[model samples]
Target: MAGVAVAAIPDDIAETHKGIVQLFSSTDDQRSVRESGQAIAALDESTKARHLEMQQSIKELTGVTNRMLDELNDRKSNLLDPTTKRELLAQKSRAEDNIRRMQEDNASLQNQVGALSNKATDLTTSEQQIKQREINEVKRAKHTISLYANISSIKWDYSSPNVKGWITAGAASTGRMRAFEMERGSHSDFQVVNHLWNLMDSV
Candidate 1:
């Protein structure tokens, strides 16, 4: 039966078996990782641009406020009538109000920039976490594939029909098989077991 089953495998399938294994072993998270990196970079660029824009706005507003204060000082020092002095006082009050409003706006912009920076930091951290998870998953997959390869290499001597003898022959072999079984059963998603079964079925 085993010989017949082996014979039943198509030549094309046997030829491509290694390719199929490679396909299954390839990490699916690579594209996600790349996309996450790109997103993070774009976000960082956007944050930087916004910060620069805020800084420019603050600089320009400060220059305008300074010029207004200088003009007020010059007017206060000049010889002026009562009506002109009252107008100067009103102008000063308006300028003070404008400066206070600009200060509030500057503070708000600073807060917004801070929030954007924090958000970018969070995204970067999340990306790093995702990469770490992918690395761990790849390691697990490699270990599982190695275990499967070891299990497949064990020869069964059906002619003598000594299952217990075969199992007991090597402690290392038994340990590896037990470890493989335990690993297979420990998956929460059952995806690893299903993947292994699929690989076996294809073989």
Candidate 2:
């Protein structure tokens, strides 16, 4: 309002302006504090958000790890289905590896959060709502082990052209959905590699 008043008045009256605009103007020192505070707040918010994401991912992957361990224990009891048995073993390997990686990721995020918290000035209470929202979303998504649903549509034949055989791709992209075993990662590319290594020995 003060700026508008100054602009609205004619230049001839500019020097004679007696309104509080000229008197109440903010100092350069105060403006610096306001802008710097805003910037710090934003950076703090983003850093916390990132830390929260890493924690959630780690938590989910830990659950996945434990599930894989249970599955391996079950397999030790009996190999009810030989085909599925081999696939399960492969998945177990991947899950164990993923869990280890997630642990490291979790630690890294925690370190970052601690460092940033020390630098931030009285902003600890900020973004509590955002952190809770992220936690809920991550928990819901990570509740289950991720498996490719389209593998059912794929058929594996002994004399297929490629070592890993061919896949119909299902709804996934032509190069994506693979016919390989579940032990392969969610994407078929890694599964195809597993097939080459395992199928030869199985046959």
What is the C-alpha lDDT profile of model 1 across 7-87, one tens digit per residue? 243577545654544554475866655665566557656866776676677777878888999999877776366877888
List per-prediction Cα lDDT, in the order shown: 0.60, 0.55
What TM-scores do the predictions have?
0.39, 0.26
Question: What C-alpha RMSD separates each model from the true structure?
Answer: 49.2, 43.4
Candidate 1 global lDDT: 0.60
Going through the candidates in the order shown, the clash numbers are 0, 0
> Once superposed on the true structure, which residue ranges of model 1 sit more than 4 Å away at CA?
1-80, 153-196
